[model samples]
Target: MTLTKQHLVNTFEGARNNNSPYVFVGIEAEGIKEVISIPSVSFDAKEQFYNNAYSNKLVHVMNSKVKIIGLTHGYPEALTDLV
Candidate 1:
């Protein structure tokens, strides 16, 4: 099920703060649409996964209707978009 608009904010908060391999931005037509501003995978200080795609694993959680704003990939060209 799609999360309510408010839940989108919560989900985004978690993702933005995450220091994991990848962050999932929750889009509910939300309040601020934040990108991961914190330190990432030792490449750049502000290289967020915004407007991109992730592994097929993410497809499980993202489903079809969900709109992705970022992705982390082994092959950068593999992803359709990158933000």
Candidate 2:
């Protein structure tokens, strides 16, 4: 099933609250839709990539329009699930 941005935000928030590892992976909304991954911890960086702004740092740089396609707890799971 195709996931929405709200789903991504919700998953991110839930993981944060539970203190569990999370890695959000998705592709660009347009063009070739290159795959990219964003670790939950990155949100806590000084850049504040996870700011309330819809056009946050990760989206602005990694993908103009990121469509979260998969979520996993840590790299091992990401590798197994996303692959």
Candidate 3:
């Protein structure tokens, strides 16, 4: 469902409480949604590839059935490593 600001906040809070490294949250106008969280792990060369692949996959899913409206991040390291 049209991802509202509250959805973003809740998603971010959930991930933050769980100590997640990255999270992708998608929603549709009809209220269908999905939330994927990347676990905390050692950073390596493959990290970039994993991030890009998963992010693309998230976008693809969102584009296919829903509209991505916001991004709320909990991990700061994602700012440096994950795009």
lDDT top scorer: 2
Number of clashing pairs per prediction, in order: 4, 0, 2
lDDT of each residue in 1-83, candidate 1, tens digit only: 43333333343444455534443343322333333323235323222232133223222244444443443332323233334
The C-alpha RMSD of each candidate to the native structure, in angstroms, is: 11.8, 4.9, 10.2
The C-alpha local distance difference test score for the whole of candidate 3 amounts to 0.46
The model with the greater TM-score, 1 or 3, is 3
**What's model 3's lDDT at 43?**
27
Report the Cα lDDT for candidate 1: 0.36
lDDT of 3 at 39: 49
**Candidate 2, lDDT over the whole model:** 0.51
lDDT tens digits by residue: candidate 3, 11-75: 55666677777655333345665443444453232234333433332343324444454454456
- The model with the greatest TM-score is 2
